[model samples]
Target: MASWSRLGRVGNLAATIIAVAGCGADDVPLTPEPGVAARKVTVIRGDQTYPMTAEVIDWETRPHPQVPERGMAVHITYRFRSTSSDSSAISEHVELQACAVDGRRVVLLCTSIFNGSSKDCWLGPSADPDLARTADVLILPDQMYAGPHAGDPKDHDGYVPPRNLGPGDQL
Candidate 1:
């Protein structure tokens, strides 16, 4: 009986360890609390790097023609700011950039572009621009993209573009 009890305890301990070890970073709750500012993320493209702030602003699990079952269509509002002297370091096509959520990367096509120019740019869905507020929706992941010059045939000063970096990969 004593040996049997000890074996049962060991089994329980092993089970607990396995359960804890199974949890990945994505398993952690990323939901942001209300009235809190979303974290800012940095993305690097080409010869420049820019800061991008994004929030889950809104989400809908409603079945759409484009989305299949068990999939959700999320609405995210984001802003991009250049860290370099040349404010235009960010491309106007930034809205089409790829974003990572819960370790899944998705491309958010620019539905609307606001305050677009050189220094500051904001992109989001066209339906509601004012809904964006600083409450926690989800943890923002660093956006990544291959710039326009990624595979240009013409070399600039013998400079070769680096390999395409996936979402969250830094320069």
Candidate 2:
């Protein structure tokens, strides 16, 4: 039994040495691509102009959740000035860039305060100006507030999306 134990220890040490040597191979140097800057713009909903920062987050291609055979999930982050006058608002819109002819952008989360408000809407892409355009100035009415959502919709004021929106001249 003692001899068997000694042999097992020797075998384990040999395996470790082989593994270490195998991992000590020369590696090819990698050249990273240039970094892309985030597009900073403003969205005018109603009376207030909300500044926005848009970023595209790409992930490994995967099957779509809804349509397993032919779909994929694309993610994006949209940070803008919190709509709330009293507090700051920072929310994210994550959706799958479907392959459909007129794919719709979905809102995954509207995080405000601590709770998340559910919002489902189809948004056009920025590439297709006809479909989606950056909102440089957001406008809102005096009675209505455009801050992030509260526990209830009535908890906050209503808002109107900005028109003639585009990327800001200087970001």
Candidate 3:
């Protein structure tokens, strides 16, 4: 089965490529709370290797369009924001360069770019509970670039790595 979402503001640039899914509502929740996997990834823009927070901002689960019998399709949307004062480190076209990993092994990955008119780049991840095991989203630093270079997006890069997003953590 494949995971995908209808295009939004960014047209082909907008990607909803979540891979967290299950055979039924029991295997995976019909709706995982938005922002569950609010995590950080290493973003490299030239000499800079900085932190960028990624969050499952929006998500939905439905029957797989191709093989509904296999299970359901999980569509999750995530965005990237530079954690440092220099926010442009994560910008347009950067989301297109990403890899989904399970441990040290790099699994299949494909994402569409949707910055929604800002540097806070959004990408949708279709889900298959089996694929969700590769829960961690790693950034392709070499491919990522700072933005057209502008003011940062509020402060979405608040979540630090090695620790899960908490109630006290500001998003």
Candidate 4:
């Protein structure tokens, strides 16, 4: 009877361990709902302050004619309106700062603005769409680059690459 009880306890412990191990950090949901995914972050750069909202509008994983590997893409929409009305206070080149995927954070070294008013715009491919849904996205304002620097460095001209901004520099 004692040996049987010990075996049962060991089985229970094994089951408990399996259950705990199966639940990873990525299993925690970041967004409460599908559409209502948004986070507000305030950024202060130099003498300027930008009140911004970063929202995950859409996520997709599809084959791209350009990318044979069929990576994931995340679409993040941003709205920014400076508290100050001064033209100098206008937020320019607002872009993503970093994204956290399964606890691993990747600084967005490359990003783009899809479209928006002076107060609104969209930026994305946050990570690969495959990884974006499982990641926490963070956006911030930084100097925008002019050309294609994220892709092949040799394919573009005058592509002055921008350095990844640290957390201290971002929101």
The regions of model 1 sitting more than 4 angstroms off are 1-39, 46-48, 51-56, 65-72, 81-87, 90-145, 156-171
- Cα lDDT of model 2 by residue, 1-171, tens digit: 999999999999999999988783644222222121123323333444433322222222233355544433322233334445544334433111111112222222111111123222222222323322222211111111225662345665443222211222121
Top TM-score prediction, candidate number: 4
After superposition, the stretches of candidate 3 with alpha carbons farther than 4 Å from their true spots are 1-39, 49-74, 84-93, 102-104, 112-114, 117-137, 144-171
Q: Candidate 1's C-alpha lDDT?
A: 0.37
User: Model 3 over residues 1-171: C-alpha lDDT tens digits?
Assistant: 123444343444534222223234453223212122213344443444546654445444445466656643445556666676875644434532333445544443434333343333322234443444444443333323234432344643322122222212222
Query: How does model 4 fare in lDDT?
Result: 0.42
Count clashes in each candidate, considering only residues at least 3 apart in sequence or on different chains.
Answer: 2, 25, 20, 4
Each prediction's whole-model lDDT (CA): 0.37, 0.31, 0.40, 0.42
CA lDDT for candidate 3:
0.40
* Rank ordering of all candidates by lDDT, starting from the highest: 4, 3, 1, 2
Residue-level lDDT for 163 in candidate 3: 21
